[model samples]
Target chain A: MQLPVLNNTPSQAEHGAKGGCSASSCGTTDNQMDSLPDSIREKVQNHPCYSEDAHHYFARMHVAVAPACNIQCHYCNRKYDCANESRPGVVSELLTPDQAVKKTMAVAATIPQMTVLGIAGPGDPLANPERTFETFRRLSEEAPDIKLCVSTNGLALPDAVEELSKHNIDHVTITINTVDPEIGAKIYPWIFWNNKRIKGIKGAKILIEQQQKGLEMLIAKGILVKVNSVMIPGVNDQHLAEVSRVVKSKGAFLHNVMPLIAEAEHGTFYGVMGQRGPTPDELQDLQDSCSGDMNMMRHCRQCRADAVGLLGEDRGDEFTLDKIEEMDIDYQAAMEKRKVIHQAIQEEMDSKRLEKAVKAQQHQQEPKLTTRPVLMAVATSGQGVINVHFGHAKEFLIYEASPEGVRFISHRKADQYCGGDSTCGDGESVLQLTIRALAGCEAVLCSKVGYEPWEMLEAAGIAPNGEHAMEPIEDAVMAVYKEMAAAGKLDEKNEAVRANA
Target chain B: MAVSIIDLCVNCFACEPVCPSHAISEAKPHFMVDPKKCTECEGDFPVFQCASICPIEGAILDSFGVAINPPGSLTGIPPEKMAEAMAELQSH
Candidate 1:
């Protein structure tokens, strides 16, 4: 089936809207993919992590075959028994190359949506070169249809690039937290180089050089490189903009600035030291600041090393080595089934995009409602839907709705008010903090909200809305704006009365 | 004694406004019980308002931290069976 090209050009009305975004700066996946060459688009068209839209229809799985890391980061605590933790370095079970291939085949047979197989380890993939390459080599020959990718810490990346190019691996992710050695020293305590453990500034310097070199070499070899940076507050947060700039200039296809997961129970060095992760607001702001230079991936779920199923959900427990060994998978029939399912999904998505484009064009022809844009806050856990609960939201995506269209403004971080039952003693203060964080917004849209916050938000002049639960955030914001306009509550004269109401 | 909304509460907004003391306010992850203001429906109603309206089983606990609505009370689906059913559904 021929895929439909996305229509991302902004309508005239949208261009005339206040704080309007140009096609390039709109930050929608459609426009981002449209700008890329056909070659790169084909590579990321079905890879869930690489394209935001692909995640909705396609699923990806990771194999935890590589269990040796060359560098030690303060934030990393690679736990083998952590079944509940959903972070990077935690895997319930480790598999050998043969077991990994068997598991992948079983998953592919069961999950028709599985399109990409990645080797992002509980440790760096490149560090365990033989095991990683062996798994890749076998999979490439046996399951040649599945797109293969690898993620590394870049300590062994420069050395392994030539071997990596030999395999069918087209996508490579390097965790380049910072280009500056000073900030890198704070994150990486030591790196094993030249058969010795090197520590402090000197170790950081060598790691950064290798990462930059590895990134350049992969790009030169026509492989798409995605740079993953952990945003550690006060450590690398302020310096990540420079990292983004450097990576983008060096031809990194996408930059994913992920927040540092520093919960104290994780028992990492930073967590034990009481180092807090970046607030969602800070992470979004940094992402927005760097987005001007290149495409930023905002939909990363930070999957576990052995994560399975779709982006948000994990089904790894069902596909353990024992389970795979017991099951007989006819991969030929499974591939045929997958082809039919994928083609149907593509056709449905193409029609949906076409309908959306037509609606946008019609919206541009409509008469203007008002020149002033109403700002509203949306609670979302990604996928562009208002699907999060009010009290559960760590941050709210702010949107500006005017006569033109709804445009995303920025993210406002809120202190999570409800910490379940064990930590309700500080609820009142946290709610107050959350309210203070959303001072400027006129309404808060979420899937569900408790009554106390409903009253409190209304009292504070910000309307709490749960009616549009699970709706696309932009459509919901525009609906609220039109509701206000239809009620004559959007004019300057009714502002006071509207707030009081 | 205050009735606490545990992690099992789905933030369904069923118990918040029903609280006579208005002690069941919103919080991150789930709702809470404010110890200072909670009357537990004493001198107002015969039973705890929050516990009466809550939909999830074992979501509301008493002062002693024992669940007022224990498992299998509300949904009639046993916790073990519910887990099995949910896992079965998600596998597809």
Candidate 2:
């Protein structure tokens, strides 16, 4: 199946020539967003983690106030002094409710784009009810404009839904790995419930029932729910599509299938036992399979519990407890500035949409180009841009370009050739493997390509181009296809020669 | 009989919170279960809480020094099959 076309705009090929949708333009005009009620749309429009479009413009922060979890996940290794770690369940420092509020105010004052405050936790937010609720209570009273979010394991979620709604918590994330108790048994060892520890499939059954019940109850209160499932290679990878389907049927607004991080250094059970995380290709395939059932959030960064700033960045150190204590923040003045800034951003986005509409109209009036479809690969680190370096790319998003427009085919996993150093010891064989991974692609587009890989790609009959660096992947792939067509490379005989080469 | 967490524990902190007896504490290498306070969930839980939540195979032992959650009990993937899967992944 083709990647979901997010926008309501006509296909680029329908515009005849020199017309393709950019990531920002397409994401902003999401058909799904248009279908939602105005209230629901307003809630998600600016949440960086909720709307794939808004992440480019907005920022979110997670306060590590909750440090206790009720359920045991094999992938979790919650410890302290994890300042450099980027995974969930890791935090630099734990904060009290008052300190968390102070830090939030300080961050909001300094960063006007910071509009959402989430309590994702170094542990389950609902598990630490008092600490989590106290932080939310203070934030809701002081900073009423900022969105409040809570993410839970869903074990304690059913019991805490009432308190969540009381605090105006509209966005809730539940990490539901599976609906089947047997598969859940592999991921969660036990859950403490009703003053007792339930183990194996029994505990899983209780957790799943509570999660489904919590999802229904939250939706009844008109709260938006996003289901996050960890894609464990053998454990729950194959089971996640069903989970997505089940959650979507239960009124979940979005599904974020995050890859499990099982690196041995994290000291998790799966890591020590040599359990492998799903490859990028495997993850993309699962997301694609489930996209038909629900709106698949393809831009999740699997943020840390104490994550700060934008989705891909962290600025937690900027607003530490000590730093917050020293600085006096005038929240009233900050709120005024934020309102003006948010209005300006909305105006800019409006103009961008208008510009894209005009371009589409112009292209539609032009004569169509007769070109054959060619598959091209793009190196991107999300945001739908051709931004990743050739050596650093873990996956290449394959796209098909023809007179029909550019369409995302699938993702191809590549063994990274560069290890972030100047060493090139075994780069040759790795590069060969990468090229083999992109067998049918006519060209590979990236931000930058090394001289050796460029030469090798050319020898392999796959043109390598970095000219469209930072451009939208769809636009870049279409431009490359146009270039190939101009060079008569799309001719039947030329195609045969390249294939045989 | 009280349960014990061996050196094989990876410091995952899974067992510390679920202990009904409040017997588990963080130590240098890994978590340790106190014999004095440990009840093994005799009247509280059907299964030992520490052994039930410990992710590593054979990380927690019973009073007789036998693994509560032995290899292949949690994941259900046999040791040989797990090794094969890892080798295949590494080869890729």
Candidate 3:
């Protein structure tokens, strides 16, 4: 799943200039590639949907193993084979978890580019908890290298995310069309929850709350979350931008605005009742408008539950249930091997956590600096610390600090760095607005900052502290002051801030 | 199973009450027929009960991919007969 080198793309420089990406070569051989944290790189390296570069090279497959759904939506018709139609929840056959594992192994062996296995069903994966978890539990051990992905409607996600994390399911996609229950009612007809059926706006409201809660929980646990929004015309078409805003604020890695497929043939209520699918131009316009300060995935094929091979191409017919069942496979031996693999993965994760803990302890023991602290800014959603990414930051909370203490100064509104209209401006222009918002700050601390903004800030003599840690604002300010004091650069930073002010 | 709704279901719910096996139930996108509970309306009706009442043409297919309620199933007129009738009507 090796991606082509950045030098190969004619628009590589333009992409780097966009301000979100770092200007390093996209080649795996480069030193800059090595500098990326293993957690981040490994998550993106082989995952086709997550990594734009890898989507061309690597491939992913979805197993239609979950056959039960708790909610009813106007757009879905699970009875139809989702594979042939270009929408979610269409599978020719629904396999048991065991059968699913065998199919996955067979596909992996045949297709070298198949690096990801997703469980996006003809039904919500979370609704069929036992089957979905069983498939993940076996795959986590059997195909550890094949990144496990799941797409849910988020109705059952709040209860399922913790167990999903235990199975080491790193990537999760939640299809959230709208945040407004009034609008959601038009999309989702009813939901079965807590042994009762709730209908209309009430059910939609409950679903919205649960989805938001599940999103925040997943983000807090550091799971790579992607939101899939089906652009339902005359229902939530005008509302997806708000969906984009909310999900991006909650730290969704990508928002995929898919078009509604309301063909009359698919016994779906929407199709039967004459709900029209968005035109190509209408879909594009909605996506453009919803692009608010977040990355929007435009290449989604709206794949079926049993879709295989690359995003655009369908290779599902070759790996049918009948075909996989005929193969000479050693089921008993595979199970035995899975146990050993599970043990090894557990040991590796344990060692990594231990190493991280030791490094943090040592970092805390470093000496403090005596340099006077000038104004510093932090991007945070909560009032406490710098945990949000710079691109997602709507405002920056300013803080003033000295060797003695750190104090909250004021908050400044910052322009949305991503999303909204594409023609409003480019990333470089937005970076300038951000810099202007942080006027006299010596440095701005954030959980992450893109390459363009990093370079722009450096040129402006405003240090960009892009540390991927959720540290308290006071502690972060003090640590920076101590580091600057140790390097004999504290006075220099303070002078720059004063001169700029 | 009596009749299975493929992806072509329009979810009109016209066939739900007609199934005597009680296999058909409300489901996402359309309805589902539980294979274990289905008897294909053996004792309940002469024709496949669910398909007999289904409104959408070719919406219900049997295990052999033959539509239980194929096109013209509702009108009770074969395509050939319909063509002949149209020819007769034009002459009149």
A266 Cα displacement, candidate 3 (Å) = 2.0
lDDT of each: 0.74, 0.75, 0.67
Mark the 10 consecutive residues where model 1 chain A has the least summed lDDT. Answer: A1-10
lDDT: worst 10-residue window of model 2 chain B: B73-82
What is candidate 1's lDDT per residue for A107-207, written digit by digit as tens? 98899889899999877888778889999999989988788999999988888889889888999999999998988888987776754456679989999
Tell me the tens digit of each residue's lDDT in model 2 across B1-92. Answer: 78898988766565787788899997977789999999989898787877765546788999999988787665444667666655655674
RMSD in angstroms between candidate 2 and the native structure over all alpha carbons: 6.6
The DockQ-based CAPRI class assigned to model 3 is incorrect
Native-vs-model 2 lDDT?
Answer: 0.75
Pick by TM-score: which candidate is best? Answer: 2
DockQ ranking from best candidate downward:
2, 3, 1
Can you give the DockQ of every candidate in the order shown? 0.01, 0.15, 0.04
DockQ of 1: 0.01
Q: Model 1 — TM-score against the truth?
A: 0.70
Comparison by TM-score, 1 against 2, better one: 2
Off by over 4 Å in 2: A1-37, A79-81, A293-296, A357-466, A469-477, A485-501, B1-92
